[model samples]
Target: MQQLLLQMLDGTVTSLKVFVLTLIFSLPLGFIVAKGRMSRNFLLRGIVNLYIQIMRGTPLILQLIFVYFAPYYVIGFSYDRFTAVIVAFVLNYSAYFAEIYRSGLQSIEKGQYEACKVLGFSKTHTFFFIILPQVVKRILPSLGNEVVTLVKDTALAQTIGVSELFRVAQNAASRMFSTMPIFVAGVFYFIMNYIVSKMFDFFEKKLSYYR
Candidate 1:
Protein backbone atom coordinates (compact mmCIF):
# COMPACT_ATOMS: atom_id res chain seq x y z
CA MET A 1 0.00 0.00 0.00
CA GLN A 2 2.80 2.38 0.88
CA GLN A 3 4.57 1.53 -2.37
CA LEU A 4 1.42 2.11 -4.37
CA LEU A 5 0.93 5.44 -2.67
CA LEU A 6 4.51 6.37 -3.50
CA GLN A 7 4.00 5.52 -7.12
CA MET A 8 0.84 7.60 -7.16
CA LEU A 9 2.75 10.49 -5.68
CA ASP A 10 5.27 10.22 -8.50
CA GLY A 11 2.47 10.39 -11.01
CA THR A 12 1.00 13.40 -9.21
CA VAL A 13 4.37 15.13 -9.40
CA THR A 14 4.53 14.58 -13.14
CA SER A 15 1.08 16.12 -13.58
CA LEU A 16 2.02 19.06 -11.37
CA LYS A 17 5.19 19.72 -13.35
CA VAL A 18 3.33 19.89 -16.63
CA PHE A 19 0.65 22.15 -15.18
CA VAL A 20 3.20 24.53 -13.69
CA LEU A 21 5.31 24.76 -16.82
CA THR A 22 2.31 25.31 -19.03
CA LEU A 23 1.09 28.21 -16.89
CA ILE A 24 4.56 29.74 -16.61
CA PHE A 25 4.99 29.82 -20.38
CA SER A 26 1.40 30.25 -21.48
CA LEU A 27 0.30 33.27 -19.41
CA PRO A 28 2.91 35.76 -20.56
CA LEU A 29 2.99 34.37 -24.10
CA GLY A 30 -0.76 34.75 -24.20
CA PHE A 31 -0.53 38.38 -23.13
CA ILE A 32 1.95 39.09 -25.91
CA VAL A 33 -0.21 37.37 -28.49
CA ALA A 34 -3.20 39.31 -27.25
CA LYS A 35 -1.34 42.56 -27.78
CA GLY A 36 -0.30 41.54 -31.26
CA ARG A 37 -3.82 40.55 -32.17
CA MET A 38 -4.89 44.02 -31.13
CA SER A 39 -1.98 45.85 -32.70
CA ARG A 40 -2.55 49.16 -34.48
CA ASN A 41 -0.82 47.82 -37.53
CA PHE A 42 -3.36 46.04 -39.72
CA LEU A 43 -0.88 43.51 -41.05
CA LEU A 44 0.39 42.51 -37.65
CA ARG A 45 -3.11 42.21 -36.24
CA GLY A 46 -4.22 40.11 -39.17
CA ILE A 47 -1.25 37.78 -38.87
CA VAL A 48 -1.69 37.26 -35.16
CA ASN A 49 -5.42 36.72 -35.55
CA LEU A 50 -4.83 34.10 -38.23
CA TYR A 51 -2.29 32.31 -36.08
CA ILE A 52 -4.71 32.29 -33.18
CA GLN A 53 -7.40 30.85 -35.42
CA ILE A 54 -5.13 28.02 -36.52
CA MET A 55 -4.22 27.11 -32.98
CA ARG A 56 -7.80 27.36 -31.75
CA GLY A 57 -9.06 25.26 -34.63
CA THR A 58 -6.79 22.27 -34.16
CA PRO A 59 -7.18 19.49 -31.60
CA LEU A 60 -4.51 19.57 -28.93
CA ILE A 61 -3.60 15.96 -29.55
CA LEU A 62 -2.93 16.71 -33.20
CA GLN A 63 -0.88 19.72 -32.24
CA LEU A 64 1.09 17.59 -29.80
CA ILE A 65 1.91 15.07 -32.52
CA PHE A 66 2.89 17.79 -34.96
CA VAL A 67 5.13 19.55 -32.50
CA TYR A 68 6.76 16.30 -31.42
CA PHE A 69 7.25 14.81 -34.88
CA ALA A 70 7.33 17.64 -37.41
CA PRO A 71 10.85 18.79 -36.71
CA TYR A 72 12.25 15.33 -37.23
CA TYR A 73 10.54 14.98 -40.58
CA VAL A 74 11.11 18.47 -41.89
CA ILE A 75 14.36 19.57 -40.31
CA GLY A 76 16.00 16.33 -39.29
CA PHE A 77 15.73 17.33 -35.65
CA SER A 78 13.66 16.02 -32.79
CA TYR A 79 12.66 17.62 -29.53
CA ASP A 80 12.26 15.78 -26.26
CA ARG A 81 8.69 14.68 -25.76
CA PHE A 82 8.38 16.71 -22.55
CA THR A 83 9.65 19.79 -24.32
CA ALA A 84 7.28 19.26 -27.21
CA VAL A 85 4.32 18.78 -24.91
CA ILE A 86 5.04 21.96 -22.98
CA VAL A 87 5.59 23.93 -26.16
CA ALA A 88 2.39 22.70 -27.72
CA PHE A 89 0.42 23.32 -24.57
CA VAL A 90 1.83 26.82 -24.31
CA LEU A 91 0.88 27.64 -27.89
CA ASN A 92 -2.56 26.13 -27.53
CA TYR A 93 -3.43 28.04 -24.38
CA SER A 94 -1.93 31.25 -25.68
CA ALA A 95 -4.55 31.37 -28.40
CA TYR A 96 -7.33 30.89 -25.90
CA PHE A 97 -5.82 33.42 -23.53
CA ALA A 98 -5.35 35.91 -26.31
CA GLU A 99 -9.06 35.84 -27.03
CA ILE A 100 -9.85 36.15 -23.36
CA TYR A 101 -7.62 39.21 -23.10
CA ARG A 102 -8.95 40.74 -26.28
CA SER A 103 -12.51 40.42 -25.10
CA GLY A 104 -11.64 41.92 -21.72
CA LEU A 105 -9.88 44.83 -23.34
CA GLN A 106 -12.76 45.42 -25.70
CA SER A 107 -15.33 45.25 -22.93
CA ILE A 108 -13.99 48.38 -21.28
CA GLU A 109 -15.76 51.64 -22.09
CA LYS A 110 -14.12 53.87 -24.72
CA GLY A 111 -14.28 56.79 -22.31
CA GLN A 112 -11.62 55.20 -20.14
CA TYR A 113 -9.01 55.67 -22.83
CA GLU A 114 -10.15 59.22 -23.34
CA ALA A 115 -9.98 59.86 -19.61
CA CYS A 116 -6.44 58.54 -19.53
CA LYS A 117 -5.47 60.77 -22.43
CA VAL A 118 -7.06 63.76 -20.75
CA LEU A 119 -4.92 63.01 -17.68
CA GLY A 120 -1.81 63.31 -19.90
CA PHE A 121 -1.06 59.62 -19.62
CA SER A 122 1.01 57.97 -22.29
CA LYS A 123 -0.42 55.01 -24.16
CA THR A 124 1.88 52.65 -22.27
CA HIS A 125 1.03 54.20 -18.92
CA THR A 126 -2.65 54.13 -19.68
CA PHE A 127 -2.48 50.46 -20.52
CA PHE A 128 -0.33 49.50 -17.58
CA PHE A 129 -2.17 51.44 -14.92
CA ILE A 130 -5.63 52.39 -16.11
CA ILE A 131 -6.52 49.73 -18.63
CA LEU A 132 -4.99 46.61 -17.14
CA PRO A 133 -6.75 46.72 -13.81
CA GLN A 134 -10.20 46.76 -15.36
CA VAL A 135 -9.21 44.21 -17.91
CA VAL A 136 -7.89 41.94 -15.20
CA LYS A 137 -11.09 42.27 -13.25
CA ARG A 138 -13.23 41.69 -16.31
CA ILE A 139 -11.41 38.61 -17.51
CA LEU A 140 -10.45 36.94 -14.26
CA PRO A 141 -13.51 34.73 -14.49
CA SER A 142 -12.87 33.71 -18.08
CA LEU A 143 -9.17 33.27 -17.47
CA GLY A 144 -10.00 31.09 -14.53
CA ASN A 145 -12.10 28.93 -16.79
CA GLU A 146 -9.22 28.57 -19.25
CA VAL A 147 -6.85 27.65 -16.44
CA VAL A 148 -9.22 24.95 -15.26
CA THR A 149 -9.43 23.73 -18.82
CA LEU A 150 -5.65 23.66 -18.89
CA VAL A 151 -5.51 21.43 -15.82
CA LYS A 152 -7.66 18.92 -17.64
CA ASP A 153 -5.69 19.45 -20.82
CA THR A 154 -2.56 18.23 -19.06
CA ALA A 155 -3.93 14.76 -19.62
CA LEU A 156 -3.44 15.39 -23.32
CA ALA A 157 0.29 15.23 -22.74
CA GLN A 158 -0.09 11.48 -22.67
CA THR A 159 -0.59 11.56 -26.42
CA ILE A 160 3.04 12.47 -26.83
CA GLY A 161 4.20 9.91 -24.25
CA VAL A 162 5.18 12.53 -21.64
CA SER A 163 4.42 10.35 -18.62
CA GLU A 164 2.12 12.91 -17.07
CA LEU A 165 -0.42 11.61 -14.59
CA PHE A 166 -2.55 9.77 -17.11
CA ARG A 167 0.49 8.40 -18.91
CA VAL A 168 2.05 7.20 -15.67
CA ALA A 169 -1.19 5.58 -14.63
CA GLN A 170 -1.52 3.93 -18.02
CA ASN A 171 1.97 2.55 -17.75
CA ALA A 172 1.34 1.24 -14.25
CA ALA A 173 -1.91 -0.37 -15.37
CA SER A 174 -0.19 -1.99 -18.32
CA ARG A 175 2.44 -3.47 -16.01
CA MET A 176 -0.05 -4.64 -13.41
CA PHE A 177 -2.69 -5.49 -16.01
CA SER A 178 -5.26 -3.70 -13.88
CA THR A 179 -7.31 -0.51 -14.15
CA MET A 180 -6.78 0.58 -10.55
CA PRO A 181 -4.09 3.16 -11.28
CA ILE A 182 -6.12 4.65 -14.09
CA PHE A 183 -9.01 5.28 -11.72
CA VAL A 184 -6.58 6.62 -9.15
CA ALA A 185 -5.18 9.06 -11.71
CA GLY A 186 -8.68 10.19 -12.57
CA VAL A 187 -9.24 10.99 -8.89
CA PHE A 188 -6.03 12.98 -8.78
CA TYR A 189 -7.12 14.98 -11.80
CA PHE A 190 -10.46 15.71 -10.20
CA ILE A 191 -8.81 16.84 -6.97
CA MET A 192 -6.42 19.13 -8.82
CA ASN A 193 -9.20 20.68 -10.86
CA TYR A 194 -11.30 21.16 -7.77
CA ILE A 195 -8.49 22.96 -6.01
CA VAL A 196 -7.96 25.20 -9.00
CA SER A 197 -11.64 25.99 -9.26
CA LYS A 198 -11.80 26.87 -5.58
CA MET A 199 -8.75 29.10 -5.87
CA PHE A 200 -10.28 30.91 -8.82
CA ASP A 201 -13.52 31.34 -6.95
CA PHE A 202 -11.60 32.95 -4.10
CA PHE A 203 -9.86 35.31 -6.49
CA GLU A 204 -13.13 36.16 -8.13
CA LYS A 205 -14.65 37.06 -4.81
CA LYS A 206 -11.64 39.15 -3.85
CA LEU A 207 -11.89 41.05 -7.12
CA SER A 208 -15.58 41.63 -6.65
CA TYR A 209 -14.85 45.20 -5.64
CA TYR A 210 -14.26 46.04 -9.29
CA ARG A 211 -17.58 44.57 -10.28
Candidate 2:
Protein backbone atom coordinates (compact mmCIF):
# COMPACT_ATOMS: atom_id res chain seq x y z
CA MET A 1 0.00 0.00 0.00
CA GLN A 2 2.83 2.42 0.77
CA GLN A 3 4.45 1.71 -2.57
CA LEU A 4 1.14 2.16 -4.33
CA LEU A 5 0.54 5.46 -2.56
CA LEU A 6 3.92 6.72 -3.71
CA GLN A 7 3.17 5.76 -7.28
CA MET A 8 -0.20 7.45 -7.06
CA LEU A 9 1.46 10.59 -5.73
CA ASP A 10 3.64 10.78 -8.82
CA GLY A 11 0.55 10.38 -10.96
CA THR A 12 -1.15 13.17 -9.03
CA VAL A 13 1.65 15.50 -10.06
CA THR A 14 1.03 14.82 -13.72
CA SER A 15 -2.70 15.21 -13.33
CA LEU A 16 -2.29 18.49 -11.49
CA LYS A 17 0.09 19.72 -14.15
CA VAL A 18 -2.46 19.06 -16.88
CA PHE A 19 -5.22 20.76 -14.91
CA VAL A 20 -3.18 23.89 -14.12
CA LEU A 21 -1.61 24.27 -17.55
CA THR A 22 -4.91 23.74 -19.35
CA LEU A 23 -6.69 26.43 -17.33
CA ILE A 24 -3.78 28.86 -17.67
CA PHE A 25 -3.67 28.61 -21.44
CA SER A 26 -7.32 27.94 -22.20
CA LEU A 27 -8.89 30.78 -20.22
CA PRO A 28 -7.00 33.44 -22.14
CA LEU A 29 -7.45 31.71 -25.46
CA GLY A 30 -11.15 31.37 -24.76
CA PHE A 31 -11.49 35.07 -24.15
CA ILE A 32 -9.69 35.80 -27.39
CA VAL A 33 -11.86 33.31 -29.25
CA ALA A 34 -14.97 34.83 -27.69
CA LYS A 35 -13.92 38.24 -28.93
CA GLY A 36 -13.32 36.83 -32.35
CA ARG A 37 -16.70 35.12 -32.36
CA MET A 38 -18.33 38.44 -31.54
CA SER A 39 -16.20 40.47 -33.91
CA ARG A 40 -17.71 42.45 -36.75
CA ASN A 41 -15.11 40.98 -39.07
CA PHE A 42 -16.95 38.29 -40.99
CA LEU A 43 -13.88 36.21 -41.76
CA LEU A 44 -12.59 36.25 -38.22
CA ARG A 45 -15.99 35.41 -36.79
CA GLY A 46 -16.41 32.51 -39.20
CA ILE A 47 -12.99 31.13 -38.45
CA VAL A 48 -13.50 31.27 -34.73
CA ASN A 49 -16.94 29.73 -35.03
CA LEU A 50 -15.53 26.87 -37.07
CA TYR A 51 -12.89 26.17 -34.48
CA ILE A 52 -15.40 26.19 -31.66
CA GLN A 53 -17.71 23.88 -33.54
CA ILE A 54 -15.00 21.38 -34.33
CA MET A 55 -13.68 21.31 -30.81
CA ARG A 56 -17.04 21.00 -29.13
CA GLY A 57 -18.26 18.52 -31.71
CA THR A 58 -15.50 15.95 -31.44
CA PRO A 59 -14.48 13.62 -28.60
CA LEU A 60 -11.51 14.93 -26.64
CA ILE A 61 -9.84 11.53 -26.79
CA LEU A 62 -9.80 11.81 -30.57
CA GLN A 63 -8.26 15.23 -30.31
CA LEU A 64 -5.61 13.88 -27.96
CA ILE A 65 -4.75 11.15 -30.40
CA PHE A 66 -4.61 13.59 -33.26
CA VAL A 67 -2.45 16.05 -31.41
CA TYR A 68 0.01 13.38 -30.39
CA PHE A 69 0.24 11.80 -33.82
CA ALA A 70 -0.24 14.72 -36.22
CA PRO A 71 3.23 16.07 -35.76
CA TYR A 72 4.76 12.76 -36.64
CA TYR A 73 2.51 12.39 -39.66
CA VAL A 74 2.91 15.94 -40.91
CA ILE A 75 6.43 16.91 -39.89
CA GLY A 76 7.87 13.45 -39.45
CA PHE A 77 8.46 14.01 -35.73
CA SER A 78 6.18 14.04 -32.74
CA TYR A 79 6.51 16.27 -29.73
CA ASP A 80 6.46 14.94 -26.18
CA ARG A 81 3.33 13.09 -24.99
CA PHE A 82 2.79 15.50 -22.12
CA THR A 83 3.00 18.38 -24.55
CA ALA A 84 0.39 16.71 -26.68
CA VAL A 85 -1.87 16.23 -23.65
CA ILE A 86 -1.61 19.91 -22.73
CA VAL A 87 -2.16 21.00 -26.33
CA ALA A 88 -5.21 18.83 -26.80
CA PHE A 89 -6.77 19.69 -23.45
CA VAL A 90 -6.13 23.38 -23.91
CA LEU A 91 -7.63 23.52 -27.36
CA ASN A 92 -10.67 21.48 -26.37
CA TYR A 93 -11.48 23.41 -23.21
CA SER A 94 -10.89 26.81 -24.80
CA ALA A 95 -13.82 26.33 -27.12
CA TYR A 96 -16.16 25.57 -24.24
CA PHE A 97 -14.87 28.50 -22.23
CA ALA A 98 -15.29 30.83 -25.21
CA GLU A 99 -18.99 30.02 -25.41
CA ILE A 100 -19.38 30.59 -21.71
CA TYR A 101 -17.65 33.94 -22.07
CA ARG A 102 -19.75 34.81 -25.08
CA SER A 103 -22.98 34.16 -23.21
CA GLY A 104 -21.83 36.17 -20.20
CA LEU A 105 -20.76 39.07 -22.36
CA GLN A 106 -24.03 39.05 -24.23
CA SER A 107 -26.02 38.90 -20.98
CA ILE A 108 -24.80 42.34 -19.94
CA GLU A 109 -27.26 45.11 -20.86
CA LYS A 110 -26.31 47.45 -23.67
CA GLY A 111 -27.14 50.38 -21.40
CA GLN A 112 -23.97 49.63 -19.47
CA TYR A 113 -21.93 50.16 -22.62
CA GLU A 114 -23.82 53.32 -23.47
CA ALA A 115 -23.26 54.57 -19.95
CA CYS A 116 -19.53 53.90 -20.27
CA LYS A 117 -19.52 55.79 -23.57
CA VAL A 118 -21.25 58.75 -21.97
CA LEU A 119 -18.60 58.72 -19.25
CA GLY A 120 -16.04 59.22 -22.04
CA PHE A 121 -14.30 55.99 -21.16
CA SER A 122 -12.00 54.52 -23.77
CA LYS A 123 -13.38 51.30 -25.25
CA THR A 124 -10.52 49.26 -23.84
CA HIS A 125 -10.81 50.88 -20.44
CA THR A 126 -14.56 50.41 -20.34
CA PHE A 127 -14.30 46.77 -21.27
CA PHE A 128 -11.49 45.86 -18.91
CA PHE A 129 -12.62 47.86 -15.92
CA ILE A 130 -16.38 48.09 -16.01
CA ILE A 131 -17.55 45.14 -18.07
CA LEU A 132 -15.14 42.33 -17.42
CA PRO A 133 -15.64 42.10 -13.68
CA GLN A 134 -19.35 41.69 -14.12
CA VAL A 135 -18.79 39.10 -16.81
CA VAL A 136 -16.55 37.12 -14.52
CA LYS A 137 -19.12 37.14 -11.78
CA ARG A 138 -21.84 35.93 -14.10
CA ILE A 139 -19.75 33.21 -15.70
CA LEU A 140 -18.27 31.81 -12.52
CA PRO A 141 -20.78 28.98 -12.19
CA SER A 142 -20.34 27.78 -15.75
CA LEU A 143 -16.60 28.13 -15.48
CA GLY A 144 -16.67 26.10 -12.28
CA ASN A 145 -18.52 23.32 -14.01
CA GLU A 146 -15.87 23.19 -16.71
CA VAL A 147 -13.08 23.26 -14.18
CA VAL A 148 -14.50 20.24 -12.40
CA THR A 149 -14.91 18.55 -15.72
CA LEU A 150 -11.27 19.22 -16.48
CA VAL A 151 -10.32 17.36 -13.34
CA LYS A 152 -11.91 14.23 -14.75
CA ASP A 153 -10.74 14.97 -18.25
CA THR A 154 -7.12 14.91 -17.17
CA ALA A 155 -7.55 11.16 -17.01
CA LEU A 156 -8.00 11.25 -20.75
CA ALA A 157 -4.37 12.23 -21.02
CA GLN A 158 -3.59 8.63 -20.24
CA THR A 159 -4.92 7.79 -23.69
CA ILE A 160 -1.82 9.41 -25.07
CA GLY A 161 0.42 7.74 -22.47
CA VAL A 162 0.79 10.75 -20.13
CA SER A 163 0.45 8.45 -17.08
CA GLU A 164 -1.95 10.73 -15.24
CA LEU A 165 -3.74 9.60 -12.10
CA PHE A 166 -6.26 7.31 -13.75
CA ARG A 167 -3.60 5.49 -15.70
CA VAL A 168 -1.50 5.06 -12.62
CA ALA A 169 -4.47 3.68 -10.77
CA GLN A 170 -5.09 1.22 -13.55
CA ASN A 171 -1.47 0.09 -13.52
CA ALA A 172 -1.47 -0.41 -9.77
CA ALA A 173 -4.75 -2.26 -9.88
CA SER A 174 -3.45 -4.55 -12.57
CA ARG A 175 -0.27 -5.26 -10.64
CA MET A 176 -1.93 -5.76 -7.26
CA PHE A 177 -4.94 -7.61 -8.70
CA SER A 178 -7.15 -5.36 -6.62
CA THR A 179 -9.38 -2.39 -7.35
CA MET A 180 -8.19 -0.46 -4.28
CA PRO A 181 -5.84 1.76 -6.20
CA ILE A 182 -8.54 2.70 -8.70
CA PHE A 183 -10.84 3.54 -5.82
CA VAL A 184 -8.18 5.74 -4.33
CA ALA A 185 -7.82 7.53 -7.62
CA GLY A 186 -11.56 8.20 -7.62
CA VAL A 187 -11.21 9.64 -4.14
CA PHE A 188 -8.49 11.92 -5.42
CA TYR A 189 -10.73 13.16 -8.21
CA PHE A 190 -13.61 13.69 -5.84
CA ILE A 191 -11.39 15.68 -3.50
CA MET A 192 -10.07 17.78 -6.35
CA ASN A 193 -13.58 18.49 -7.57
CA TYR A 194 -14.73 19.37 -4.07
CA ILE A 195 -11.91 21.86 -3.68
CA VAL A 196 -12.63 23.36 -7.07
CA SER A 197 -16.29 23.70 -6.21
CA LYS A 198 -15.49 25.42 -2.93
CA MET A 199 -13.11 27.83 -4.58
CA PHE A 200 -15.70 28.84 -7.14
CA ASP A 201 -18.32 29.15 -4.44
CA PHE A 202 -16.01 31.49 -2.56
CA PHE A 203 -15.42 33.60 -5.63
CA GLU A 204 -19.12 33.74 -6.38
CA LYS A 205 -19.85 35.07 -2.93
CA LYS A 206 -17.01 37.57 -3.19
CA LEU A 207 -18.40 38.87 -6.45
CA SER A 208 -22.03 38.64 -5.43
CA TYR A 209 -22.04 42.41 -5.29
CA TYR A 210 -22.02 42.39 -9.07
CA ARG A 211 -25.56 41.11 -8.95
The residue-by-residue lDDT of candidate 1 on 148-174, one tens digit each, is: 888888888888787777877778889
> Model 2, 1-211: lDDT tens per residue?
8888898989999999999999999999999999999999999999999999999999999999999999899999968899999999999999999999999999999999999999999999999999999899889999999999999999999998889899999999999899999999999999999999999999999988745
In model 1, pairs of residues that clash are none
CA error at residue 110 for candidate 2, angstroms:
0.5
TM-score of each: 0.94, 0.98
Worst 10 residues of 2 by lDDT: 202-211
> What is each predicted model's overall lDDT from 0 to 1?
0.88, 0.94
**Which candidate number would show the highest TM-score if scored against the true structure?**
2
Please give the clash total of every predicted structure, in order. 0, 0
